[model samples]
Target: MLKFIALRLLQGMLVLLGIYAVTFVLVAATPGSPFSSERAIAPEILAQIEAFYGYDKPLGERFITSLGNVLQGEFGPSAVYANRTVTQIIAESFPVSIKLGSISLLLALVLGVPAGILAAVKRNTWLDYLPMSVSMAGICLPTFVMGPLLALVFGLILKMLPVAGWYGPEYVVLPATTLGLYYAAYFARLTRGGMLEMLNQDWVRTARAKGVPEHTIIWKHCLKGGLIPAITFLGPALAGIISGSFVVETIFQIPGLGQWFVRAALNRDDFLVLGLTVLFAAMIVIMNLLVDIVQVALNPRLKYD
Candidate 1:
């Protein structure tokens, strides 16, 4: 297990390095300097500013310097934000993203798993059809559309929730729900499919023949195996939730890393964009590693190579 973990970690590190290299190249290839938008500055003044930030250096030199700084845990100064570093911006905003992602994940599991189990158990009935229909609709509707609709009904019409702004606990509900429901639809379908397959397995028939209580068979024997697909989906899903919150955060006016990432891209804040990219890439790698570990734990028959 230790060897497996260490091997996975090494692979994850290599993946992160590849992501960083790709992102760095893209950012470098993008037209326009970080100071391109500045109004009517003297050429000498522009040159001085660029020199001060080491932007006057060649792209290769800058990349090497940035790589060295990152290795030492420094993300360098933000091009757009005065006196602020990329590290500082990430530190301030990541907690909000984490909070939103965590809640969304929990909501997806809580709502989706049960709905799926019920649908599978009650297959060919209204109980199955209704949830399946809803899940289909959810899969069709993108978060951009769904978010405003939710805000409109719950926040505007019912006055049950705020339309925007992430101030307190209540503010979390709308955004989290919007994000969660989208993934929940996918989860529900995956779960139902997994459960149905597990239910048809020979072991399940044997359990039934041995007179195991239906509920115990379903909950204990089937659920463990049924959940494998959902568990596997969680790794990439979690990464998506964290990085994809840009839309949700924007719609709801939440101050999270996703929002920062959006601004950094628009503003051409090279370091900030690269930092966020690396952070998100690292998160995805870590989550995937955890998923592999969990998969092994849940299925002793599986062995790590």
Candidate 2:
């Protein structure tokens, strides 16, 4: 187990390095200075500014320096934001993203699991048909579309929830719901399929022959193995959520990492963009590792190595 974990961590480091290198190359190749603005600075002043940030160095040297700083967990300064480091900005904003993502994930699990269980158990009945249809619709609708329609119904016409801003608990409902519902649809479908497969297994037939109560057979015997597909999706879903959903954050005016992530790209804040990319890449690696570990634990037939 320790060796497996160690191997995965090593692989994760390599993946992060590759992601960092690729992002750096892309950012460097892109035209326009991070300092570009409406007003032009004097040549000498611009030279001094570039030299101050070590941008005056050759590309290879700059890349080496940036990589060293990244290894030490520093992301340098933000070019667009006058007095902030990339690290500082992430520190302030990542928690907001985490909060939103956590709630959204919780909501997905709460709503999706039951819906899936019902759909599977009910089979061809309306109970099965209704939720499957809704799940299909949810899958088809992108968050950009769902966010506004929800805002219109619940925020504008109903006036029950705020359309934008990251203020109180009330502010989170629409964004979280918008994000959660999409994944919930996926979870419902995955769970239903897994459960259906589990239900048809030989053990299930054996349990039924022994006259075990139907509900107990479904809940106790089937549920654990049946949830494997949902669990598989959970890792990437959690990582993506925690990294922040750019569209949802934008629509809802949330001051999360996603906001900075988008701005960093457009404004050519190189360090900030690199910092967020590395952070996101690292999260993906870690989450996938965790999912594998969890999957192994759940399935006794599976070996860690």
Candidate 2 lDDT over residue span 1-305, tens digit each = 99999999999999999999999999999999998788989999999999988999999999999999999999999988879999999999999999999999999999898999999999999999999999999999999999999999999999999999998999999999999998899899999999999998999999999999999999899998999999999989998776648899999999999989999999999999999999999988988999899999988899988
Tell me how candidate 1 scores on lDDT.
Answer: 0.92
lDDT of each: 0.92, 0.93
Model 1 ranges with Cα > 4 A deviation: none
- The candidate maximizing TM-score is 1
Q: Which regions of candidate 2 are displaced past 4 Å?
A: none
What C-alpha lDDT, on a 0 to 100 scale, does residue 139 get in candidate 1? Answer: 88
Minimal lDDT window, size 10, model 2: 238-247
Q: lDDT tens string, model 1, 95-155?
A: 9999999999999989898999999888889999999999999889999999999999999
What TM-score against the true fold does each predicted structure earn?
0.97, 0.96
